[model samples]
Target: MHSKTASSSLSTSSRIVLPNDTNVLGNLMGGQLLNWMDITSAIAAHRHCGRVVVTAAVNNVSFNHPIALGDIVTIEAKVTRAFTSSMEVFMDVYVEHRLTGEKKKCNEAIYTFVAVDQNGKSIDVPELIPESEEEKSRYDAALRRRQLSLILAGRMNANEATELKALFEQ
Candidate 1:
């Protein structure tokens, strides 16, 4: 397969926080938001690979602010990088006030997905080309994040993580 631009894999989802999606404090529940992000990010990964994709890891999530009930939540996800068979998707969550219509980013998440065949076996995916500054930044960071994750998972020795070592060498 040929390389794909990160922008070509962009995906978005919008939802209004409902009673079922909130906690007793009337704030949107983290689990509900996570579910939405998973679906949205999966779509982005699939778009990048043009194949079935499965979640391999939830690399990062930041619940920066609590979203109030009835707020309109929008999630924008895009593939940041692609490896042999996996792609990393980055997402930003924004909440719009129900009354004032004000919108602000409240959350961010990074997810990794593996492209799969009909039998669910991992398959190769096209390389990713990040055009925008933000996409390029995320693309570079994805390698560091992957190295950190590998270290944490005991899949790689800490000394072997060149990207992570750069952070401490400075």
Candidate 2:
């Protein structure tokens, strides 16, 4: 079966950050940022899988700058790696000043998704189509992230670790 591919820049999903999405300090809440990240990342996953995809894991999520209310929030997401029925997506969020239009990098994260069948079980995803050198670099990094994930999960063997090290060195 053929699967459709989709890609979008952070600006494409820009929305004004509202007070409700912010904290008492008038900055966007981390939780709210995460919610948007998950949603946007899922959009990329579904496009790659052509089916329902669930958040299996979020490896690294951190906010570097605060986004204030009235600022434009942009979240860019893309499928960087895929294996069997799972995909690893990388998302970066930015905030643009409402008046000046200057943008600042606010947050970045990596999420793992598993394509599911009607029964909610894992299913195979489509082949990824990397469009540029940067995209391919991100894909390779995601694979390294997956390897580290295995080590963290106590699933990595000595041979696997050696192979992963070699691949990452390239």
- Top TM-score model: 1
- Candidate 2 local Cα displacement, residue 166, angstroms: 4.2
Which ranges of candidate 2 are over 4 A from the true structure?
1-12, 154-159, 163-170
Positional deviation of residue 132's Cα in model 1 after best superposition, in angstroms: 1.2
Candidate 1 residue lDDT tens string, 25-143: 99999999999999999999999999999998898998889999999999999999999998999999899999999999887899999999999999999999989899899999999
What C-alpha lDDT does candidate 1 achieve relative to the native structure? 0.93
Candidates' C-alpha lDDT: 0.93, 0.80
Per-residue accuracy of model 2 over 63-163 as CA lDDT, tens digit each:
88878889999888888877889888888788899899999887778989899988999998877766678777887677778877778767776457664
Q: Model 2 scores what on Cα lDDT?
A: 0.80
